[model samples]
Target: MSGRKYVTTVGVEVHVELATRTKMFCSCLNAPQGVAPNLATCPVCLGLPGSLPVINREAVRLGIVAALALNCAVNPRIWFERKNYVYPDLVKGYQISQIAMPLGERGWLAIIGDDGAEKKVAINRVHLEEDTARLAHSGDNSLIDVNRSGAPLMEIVTDAVLRSGREAEEYVRKLRAILVYNGVSRCRIQRGEMRVEANVSIAPEGAKELGVRSEIKNQAGFNHMRSAVEYEVRRQAGALDAGGTLRQETRGWDDVNQRTFVQRSKEDAHDYRYFPEPDLPPLNIDPAWVAAVEAALPTGYEDYVAGLLGQGLTAADVDALSRNDALGFLRLAASAMGDKTVLFAKRLIKDVFALANSTGVPLDESRLGPSAFRDAALLLENGKIAAEGFRTLLDVLYREGGEAERRAGENQLFVETDAGAVAEAISKVFAENPRLIEDFKNGKIAVRNALLGRTMKAVGKRADPRVVSGLLDQALQHQGRADHDRDTRLPRGKS
Candidate 1:
């Protein structure tokens, strides 16, 4: 494998389903999950005779938004093309997609590469298309669910600039984040809202010409996508070393076997028999519309992360907040909390996120809203409630909606700041641990922490830790001075 040097070239094709209320060219419901098979279909989506297609305006607008977000140039005039193919899941023999005039072209997304440098992956086009139905295969039988059919799909193709599997993974990850942030799509890989295909080829190191590329179709996850690309690279390299030839073909990834198997020869553009769709008219994207969409785009993800970091959030917290559903909530709380943003961010990561992970509920869907979160943070900040009390209140707030103060009071979780109570607790702890006091007098000052622990336990978690530490220090110091005076007086007596 090391005799001849080779460089791997990778390009990616990502398809994302738009979160629209209806399908691409019809008014049928777009809900694909949990619906009975063929329940959401209609004449247009099922491709019944005498059915004509009409464009979904909202889907087109979303596609343009995604394209602009990727920094692509939107075409002023674009039309759909019929991509002819045969498959059971494809109700229509020809897929209505774009070829000659895609919605947008020449875009790029920046991804951090293996060398830790920002690398831009060139986007070829962001086109609009319709999704195929779901195919469920049993031992020997197959079933089609048309619920997914006709859902608006966006195809984002990237130039073959990625040199490694890691880079490809990063590219797709960044792309998904951008799309999700822009509200263009949910981009959930597990839900089939997003799919990835990698076209991989290897050429001799420093060769001016590229080698034959093979397409790996529909990798379900990022790990699978990277593995498929890496496996194909090695396979091509091994074949060339053994004086065998590689062919332009399509392959499917076997997650169980951890390898790629041939599916069919790859098809070129002409193979699709592309033609203009007569049912839908050409889409006109005016400059004013493009400008409006561009202006409405959200902050770039990098900028968003940077802003979060600047707000004193740790890098780990920033990453967690950015990737999770709680991001919007965090932002809202941060804005509302003002100078206490870092405190809220920490609590969110340490408490709310941990609960969400354990309970399998997303943060955004939790009963705890931004106002309740801010109130809890304020209580903790003002020392009205200790850390344990705050945590208890947060759990209640997350599970059941209530005011933080009312919940804290109902649970008897207020911090005990009474001076007399703290003093009595310290004296009780000293009485219980006479040996600890004697050791302190003998200069074993490090044992003060043990004494503080005892005092806190005596207070039963109602006392503030800071108050307990202060009271304990005062008692020890007073005992130390008394012992010194008694020792000096006894030494003068020569006893």
Candidate 2:
């Protein structure tokens, strides 16, 4: 037993179905959305005898691209091997997957830690495999749906780098974003398009050897994984404290009960007896084809941020922009207007993003388009329009942009800034509020604020409060000086 407190390590295996048109081994619609159950099934997918299978080119391309996006080293020469298993979901006796030579090896995903620092979680391998059909379990028996059988699945395994529950969640989120952005998979947790299983283990702080590993199976979401790991850590720590031995096992997360229950004893690698299939010929991936796929790979959000950094975006701004998709639109608007990037980012955070978030709409769907934004930003930049007018224009655009040619067309709604009109309102306010004015002359500072409020109510919020307050203060100060002068020089006969 070690003297130190505790340390936990986690590795995650994610199974994400590629969003390809056809299945991995047979040419059935890989996606079953909006289609009747079992309608997309084929003989090969149903495991009918004497049925030969052909690989989907698109699935292969996506597998390679996913590997690339994860920063994996792509293997040009790879082969598919059948993983033999007997399961209800497997219409076939075995699943065809890449075993010895996977498409990707040794990749990494960067995660942001709670301490506001970046950490990289290494991916041990990413392989191409076939997904079996799903079984719908009801009260009594189950129904089989072959529509999803033979769908292309990408299995990503991670090295044991995550040291905490939060890190594990961050790693999954980062990986999901990369997968979705690259168009390799939808990676929707709600739909079970992407699934995560965790291998959790703990060792005392100074222990040289790791404790027994328990596999937490079928973790539904990031939060579930976090909770399960936390519970496991506590359970192991308590057992160790009491001098009990930790056993290797498979546990199920009972989300409803919020506890982990023993599903069964964990299986070692040799338990299922994995063997290669002899039916399919060795998959010879040409170098030229892989290069073409790599060239067409989508640039991930991380890469986009790096590109922005090269263009001189600050670290904080980059973090903010990446968190908000509106940052992309702001970038587009800036590019179109040919403005400085930093200036655009400042305006994005200053006005555009704030308004969009307040309205609960996407930036693109907001009334502020590239042209409108550019015009508004230009007005603000040159001080041609007051901030009050700018905000008003945003409201106007939202209400009546359909009828107006430009935002300036709605300028009729803005309050007039004429000095004569403001002066008249100020004079009227002073004449009506005699007591407040007397209090102001008596050097009571609070009375000046009351006079400013009366003047504001007489006009409207559309009027610039700052300018009105300034004019009122000047008037009050002049009156005060004149009254003081008259009092000081008053003749004795008048008293």
Candidate 3:
């Protein structure tokens, strides 16, 4: 028989690669983009002898901005400590990090938990550090690219409050949004700009203390991180059920094999042998500048999401907008659209987003600005352009960066509003399809849709579908009455 059920506890650490022009402590270019190996290095980034480290003021400012965005309290005096670790990628024998006095602490953010309610996850600290070099391993060779070395990295650590894989995923998703919305970091998980580490443990049901956790290190994808957490939970529960003792250890996720494997024993704080940096002095944050940063913030992430939901956007749509960094664009379009907000949202999500995805271009990089989208959506809403015409206009505007109204006219995509032209198209379609006409008069009323399609095709797809349907219905009714009258005449005087 199995023992009592277990409960999961998770703590996540998110590493964000701060966006800046230079390295954290040096003037070397912070080029994560493809730069030749060793080209972006300097003495400070490389930790050469006789070199000194200087903090980047802009990096400090951005850190403060992020801290305020996360509702963390800024420390007046913060300093760096050398985290002593020996590895091939570490140019120096130690890393300059902050734990004794970090930039921010005691923050809390909300996420929608597994129970479909708002959950407040406590944040322990948000600190700034430098990234290590990238390691690429082949079958027989290992290489290090120092371009990522000494880049600015910010870490956010959460308390052990998450209960499930989904809660952990939600926490990361919401954190990403809050950071991106505040212009903190790009948080691109694909590019290694953002990374996640989860500490998962499971305890007996109604236990008073937490169980020993295995740290899952450097999960680059959100779903992979969730999977690692869930798998670790199950593994721990199985071991405990079989009367096996769990140990504290660090592990790596084998994404291909879908399991966690031991990497090393978990390190205690003493293992790093942290000591204060003797070269660089302590950091002092200005209250005035922090005030300005708080003042300059655009809007809170929670409020923005709430407003988007109030506009009837689904949660998935909001996620798409946030992930693509197009929330501001949608907001601008909605600001001017009034009651047509839904139409604008639909067009932005359905049409504009499709173009971006298909072409491998970002939505914000497109020439279809909010005003352009607004004009196009209005054309569709006001019956000036057919649905087919609107799509054509969108394709053109997205490709060539032209005004929607001008392009619609240039391409002759506007609906054929001329009564005579519509009637002629309808009459030609009726004359072309006698079999369909017979079907209509014989009570196969669904033939009206075919007539409508043929009419639009005759007009080069610029005819409004509503107008085509109305005219086709009237023509079919007239033909049906004529056929009825002839049938009632009793075969040439038999009546």
Candidate 4:
């Protein structure tokens, strides 16, 4: 028999490639590129003898900004230690990272749940370190690219506050937004700009101690991270049901088959043989320096979302816009288009997000800029364009710009629903369909559908079909001879 319930404990570690112009210790470019491999390395990064390392000031500032944004308390003094692990891509044979003190600690992230509930996830620490290069293994031969060696990296570790797959995904997403907003990282998971690792385990309800945790490393995207955690939850539950022991190990996700395979046993701290690096000096972050970094930081995600809600936006719409780049566009649209700001804001959010997802293009790159969307919203609100015509207008503006609105007008796509004209048209249909009208009077009520068809034909698809059908039914019942009288609102047309 399986356990009554499951408590999934989740923790995440993310590596963000700092937006810096040079490597951590050298002047070489600190960017991933299509240029031939190993061409971007220099003597300092290659760990040649008699070469000293210099700290990159810009990388430290970016890391500080990220820490403050996450609400971490900055450490007064920071230092680096050597994580000794020999590998082909790691030319230095020892990574320079923080051991004794990280830049910040004790921060928290806020997440809104599916039912509009709030959850606060805590941060353990935020530290700065250097990244190793890439390794490509081709069957019998092994290749190494040192281009990324010594690239400045920031490691943000979260406490095990996540309870489920969804919460974990939300945490990562919010973190990505903050990093992008602060201009610290590009926040691209596909391009290896940001990397994620999740630690997952299952326990009995209200258990204080955790189960044996398995670390899933190098998940490529946010979705994959969520999937890995969910899979682990199920797999471990099955094992416990069958009387199997949980092993402490590392696993890799095979995204193609949607299964995780064991990579190796979990490592202990002694395995890395960590020690202070002899080459690099201790980082001393003065009081005034941290204050400056905090001053330039951007607004957090919660504040921005609150501002949007205050602008007459529905909570659901605000939630939708929070995940995408549309927040800025929505803000701009609301400011430019005044009346019915809420309605216009909702439309822009829906269209931009829908188009961006379907076309696989970023919202910022789509032809409809904020100003263009603002124009479309104004036309929609003022009844200058019909619902159907607005769709066509969007297509035209996306493809071609010259005289697009004029062309839409000429095409008659934006037809207004005239209530009087619709009532008149329905009356004419009732006059022509005599048999259906007689059937209705004689209590054969289904014949009312025939009158509806006639009215649809009379309108020629120019008016709203819903309004036309409603009016037609009402005109049929006003005869008063029929048992069930039709609605007068439909016959009188929209007020």
Q: How accurate is candidate 4 locally (lDDT)?
A: 0.78
The residue pairs that clash in candidate 1, if any, are none
Candidate 2, residues 1-495: lDDT per residue as tens digits?
Answer: 345498798889999999888888887888766899989988988889999888788888888888888889888677787777678998888888877889899988889865679887899999988888889999999999888889999999999878878899889877876776566776767667898888889998888987898889878889999999888888888888888998899998988878788888887866656666566776777888878887865446676666667777689886666455444455455653233666777767767667767777645455566566666666655545556666767656544443223554457434457767778899999999898887666556777778888897777545666678778878877887787688863212211
Error of 1 at 294 (Å): 1.9
What is the full ranking by lDDT, best candidate first? 1, 3, 4, 2
**Tens-place lDDT digits, model 4, residues 389-437:** 5666666665554354565676665544787988887778767777777
Structural similarity to truth (TM-score) of each candidate: 0.77, 0.65, 0.75, 0.67
Best by lDDT: 1
Provide the clash count, candidate 4. Answer: 1
Of candidates 4 and 3, the better by TM-score = 3
The 10-residue segment of model 1 with minimum total lDDT is 486-495
Score each candidate by Cα lDDT. 0.86, 0.76, 0.85, 0.78
Ten contiguous residues with the weakest lDDT in model 3: 486-495
TM-score of structure candidate 1: 0.77
RMSD of 1: 5.3
Candidate 1 local accuracy as lDDT?
A: 0.86
**Candidate with best TM-score:** 1
Per-residue CA lDDT of model 3 for 249-332, tens digit only, reads: 999999999999999999999999999988789988878888988897766778877877887889998877777877766666
lDDT by residue for model 1 (204-275), tens:
999998899999999989989999999999899999999999999999999999999999999999988999
In candidate 2, which residue pairs clash? none
Cα displacement (angstroms), candidate 3, residue 472, comes to 17
